[model samples]
Target: MARLPRLSVTDLPHLVLWQGHNRHAVFADDDDRQAFLALLTDAAAREGVELHAYALLDVSLWLLVTPRRVGALPRLMQGVGRTYVRRFNQRHGRTGTLWEGRYRATVLAPQELLAALVFLDHQPVRAGLASAPEDWAWSSHRHYAGAASLRALHAPAAWWGLGDTPFAREAAYRQRVHDGLPPEHERRLHEAAVKGWPLGDAQFLAALEAQTGRRARPARPGRPRKGGSKSVPKLS
Candidate 1:
């Protein structure tokens, strides 16, 4: 069977979430997380891309990026990915690929965007790293919340549709994240963000189509599951 192709910005205007191979925890500590973000900065310099805002999780990273040029996206990814993996291997004393597969992306609308950002920020809480998203300190939450960007992230206000005033956008961002997942929607709690994969709502997605003018292709048929395969993700 064929597999659903990994979502790409080329095909959709989205909020991207992706992670390392086998759900491995590549971002160990603060330094590690910051280091990875720095790679994103370098990638931006090389690729001519603008990364609006992003969040760093234990095993993955969520990014909001747009390429300025049409053909530069792949080269941009290759440059950053290769450099990041190289550093990750050296620091951890490990060898081999650090990523699981291509990053998974999903189209999202502005109204639902706040939710997506919150989902990314709250990863640590979900992953058992901290009690709340703000407590983690490694995410781009600060950048959005009006803190001076760490330079590597290249966080810009325009990314979030925040206009010229940085303070207003920051206040709005904080409020949105502080709001949490709507009242008692526990079933969909983890669905929005599953291991760096962000899924959006049908209504908002329709709006997103209008705003970005990008259409998502249908999901491809994936490979058959092996009988008694030991690898399985436990559904919480």
Candidate 2:
């Protein structure tokens, strides 16, 4: 079996997880992270995708992006990859593709939107780069908190309409994400990791079910490993 090329899909949001080639450290250090962001911001300006959340760790990074145009994701991703790799190779005396290959992406529903936001923001902590998410400098956390100006990463002000102003809304969102998550929300994190589906309100589940044509269950069978139970035969 061969890996299929990234099928060009219509305008759909995806949760992407792209690792460095050979599991090598793509962001070797601070300089590497800055270089990557610079390229990313530039490319993002040309694409319509909204980079809602992200975290720049020491090795790999995470992102929560929604493509605004169909068939443009690959080109936009390639643009950032090429720009960063070119600089990375010149600086480190290396060459070749920096990325592993076509990135892993899962089309998601808005129901899972908040979970994705928290995960992307907390990637640094989860990866052991920092004790807290806000400590990491190279991330959209500050942007969301209204501390920094983010022109490329488009997290609209209206999303948080409760605030007296757009800046206030950003601040509120930051506090919600930064303040240690509630127990139920913490549990939600565990569920998202295993289920890979949005866990939220009943209405959200209904919407997801409609789109996927499958009811959202608490948990499903996970990927199989060898030297375990007998393989379940497929029903034809």
Candidate 3:
């Protein structure tokens, strides 16, 4: 079957995931990870994409970002991917594609932002790479948790609304992460990203479809029954 074009809308937060080819390691060492992050920071700035949260696992990376314009997200990803692949190949003395394929992404509603952030932060822990989110050195967790500051990261409104001061916000965010996502919430997030479907309630999905002229959620099962009311289907 033919693939659908990525459902990218301007001014919306998106959860993006890209994995290595054949599940191979993408970052061989600390230097490789640092280089990839530098490339990402530069590309995001040039493409006008706001980086809100990120996690770098050995075989895959997840990013939560908001693009300022229609094509900003793709441009940023392409720039970072191409440049990083070249540099990595040179440094490692290997050749061939690094990524598995096109990256997977799903647009998010305002209500889902904080949950997405927590999900991204907990990726390392879920993968058994860290005892806690704070132990992951390559992710934006440290920055959000008040242990470090990354100038390139832009905190979204949801994060800022956590508290009146930086310390307060950080503390609140840390506690939220500690609380963690429900198993069902985590499963839904993973399913949405992998399937490239927008994650939201019915109203949000309707608004998104009206604005973008594309389906934001799956269509209802089965063909329309004869003489049935011609109403739009609700998102399940």
Candidate 4:
């Protein structure tokens, strides 16, 4: 079956994921990780994509971002992916593709935004790479939890639901993570992200389809197979 083109809904936040080819370790060391983050920061700033929350794992990374205009998200991802792959290959003496293909992104609804933020932050913990979300320095958890003051990472407007003040918001976000996400929500988030489908209610999907003129959900009814939704649009 032919794959669907990626949805291009302007100004909506998306939960994005990309992994190493064959699940290999994409970040060989702390330096590699730092390099990729630097590239992301630059590309996001240049492309006007807001970096809300992120979790960088050994083989993959998760991000919560909102692009200011149509094409901003794709441009940011492409810039970072292409540059990072070049640097990674040179720095580590490797070759060929670093990523599996095009990264998968699922548009998020306003109601699900905070939960999505928590889910993004908890990825390290969920992967068993850290005892707690705060222990993962590569993620935005510290910034949101007030453990780190990283101005580069911004909290989404939906985060204001926690509180008006910075301390209140941070404390609330911290407690939410401390309580942990429900297993079902986590599983659903994982499925949506992996499948490149919008993670929202039926109405939200309908709204997205109206906006993008494309199906907001998976074209097929069943589970998305490995490599089922890969689409590498020309990066520029």
Candidate 5:
């Protein structure tokens, strides 16, 4: 079956995941990671995408972004992927596709923004690459924690709502990451991105459906009866 187009809406936060081909290491060293970030900074700027949070794992990378207009997300990803692949090939003395396939992405409601950010920050830790989020130098954790300044990074409105002062906000964000997300919530976020489903409640999904003219959530399991049922499958 043909795949559904990536669900992207302007001005909404999106969680994206891109993996290396066959689970190989995408970033061989700090230099490769730095190069990828530089390329990402350029592509995101050119495509008008606002970077919220990110984690660059050895075999995969996660990103939280908000596109300023329609088609901005894919354009940004495509531009970075193409250029990065060329440079990585030359640097590593290898060839062919660098990515597993197309990137996976899911649109998120405003309410889920902070949760998604936490999710991105904890990826390296969850993967056993680091003991703490802050130890992962390639992620946005340090930026949010005020340990580093990334020029391309943009804090979402929810982040601002964390506290009135910069230090307060940073402390609050650090605390949130320290608290960690529930396993179920993390699973939901991962599944949503992999399936390209919109992550939100009924009202939010309904509004998104109206805006996009497509199903915002998955259809119910089992066949429909003679009379239609009002129930929809809950996101697992």
Candidate 6:
């Protein structure tokens, strides 16, 4: 089957994810992580995308960003992927494809923005890398939870919705992480990222489809049987 086109639009928040081929450890040490982060930081600046939340795991990474231009995300991802892969290979003295495939991205509805951010933050905990999100050194959770201050990057405006003051926001966000997300919620976010579907409600999906004129969801799993119950029609 043909690949689905990515849903790209300006000023919309997107959750992006990409992992190492075969689930390999992409970061050997802190230096490797630093190199990858530098590439991402520079690419975001050059491509005009706003960096919001991010998490760097052993084999995968996630980013929350809003692009200022139509194709900024692609450009940013291309630049980061190329540069980081090259550096990683040279530093580690190994070769082959660095990534599993093209990164996956999903347009996030307004209400889902915070959920996505918190989800990204919780990756470390979920992976058993850290007991709490605030303990993770490679995530923007530090910035959100007041564990770190990143001068160059700014939090998404939607994050401010947590509270009026920084402390309030940080406290509230920590509480959110502490409270944790339901398994289904996390599953939806993960599945959407993997499938490159827009993460939103019916209205949000409809709006995306209307704006892009392309399907923003995955096709149904199976073909409808020709003859079902005669009295009850099959739902599409």
Query: Once all C-alphas are superposed, what RMSD does model 2 give against the true structure?
Result: 5.9
Report every candidate's CA lDDT. Answer: 0.62, 0.66, 0.92, 0.84, 0.92, 0.86
Better of 1 and 2 by TM-score: 2
Show pairs that collide, candidate 6.
none
TM accuracy, model 3: 0.94
Q: How many backbone clashes does candidate 1 have?
A: 6
TM-score of every model? 0.69, 0.71, 0.94, 0.90, 0.94, 0.92
* Model 1 poorest 10 in a row by lDDT: 189-198
lDDT of 4 by residue, 87-117 (tens): 9999888889889988998888877878988
Per-residue lDDT of candidate 3, residues 55-96 (tens digit): 999999999999997799999998899999999999999999
Q: Where's the lowest-lDDT run of ten residues in candidate 5?
A: 227-236
Tens digits of per-residue lDDT, candidate 1, 146-189, equal: 66565655443334476557677778778777887764442343
Candidate 6 TM-score, true structure as reference: 0.92
* Cα lDDT of model 6 by residue, 90-179, tens digit: 988999888988899988887888888889989988889998888889999888888889865667776788899989998998899888
Candidate 6: 10-residue stretch with minimal lDDT: 227-236
Clashing pairs for model 1 are 2-221, 2-222, 17-196, 20-100, 21-99, 21-100
Which of the two, 1 or 3, has more TM-score? 3
Tell me the lDDT of model 1 at 50: 65
